[model samples]
Target: MPGVIARILRRTPDTRYAELADMRSGFNSLAAKVQTVLDKDPYGGNIFLFRGKRGDLLKAFYWCDGGLCLFAKRLEKGRFAWPRSDSGVVALTTAQLSLLLEGFDWRQPLDAARPRTAL
Candidate 1:
């Protein structure tokens, strides 16, 4: 579960992502074309971005210093909230992805909606 791929839903345009120099991207040529907007983008050396043609689906590329890896996901019913065109990409943690999957906005300040309580 820790190294599994997680997806962001929404038909995001291929031009939304900018590539970084600190990482190597291994998406196919089609995926590469969609990432042209990110040709020289920077992620502060923590995250990477990838785009797939199937309705704006994206995969998050990341590494733990030991090696590199990719995480992918898709929304069967809705689109993801994209950042402003002028804004940089959003970075997410594994825990954050789990929250987002349950319909929580990971960027906002919120308490757990279903915290367990001792009887």
Candidate 2:
């Protein structure tokens, strides 16, 4: 499971939708966009991530287990942190993706407290 997640995170989507409602689109429509607009295979097993204009909702589209799967997340208290660029792909590590999904700043994650002394 970790290996699969790692592999998927290594391949970031080339495009991102600006509206959350747009992500509400069905599989066919999303697949069409992925095919025509991005010129990428919708069934190629790459994960595409989309964020809403308000940054509170996020959607992930990918091909999985012989079919397509769409996963969505909506934050209740805080908005998701996203890249400033409205276009192009953004590569992320597994940890960064996890942070993004958890509504944290993936670019500069909060530092952990250092050990007071070596054991």
Top of the candidates by lDDT: 2
Give the Å shift of residue 92 in candidate 1: 5.7
Residue 29's lDDT within candidate 1 is: 40
Residue 80 shift from truth in candidate 1, angstroms: 1.6
TM-score on alpha carbons, each prediction: 0.41, 0.74
lDDT against the true structure, each candidate: 0.43, 0.68
Which segments of candidate 1 are over 4 A away from where they belong?
A: 1-45, 51-56, 90-119
Clash count, candidate 2: 1
Model 2 alpha-carbon drift over 4 Å, by segment: 1-21
Candidate 1: residue 26 lDDT (0-100): 59
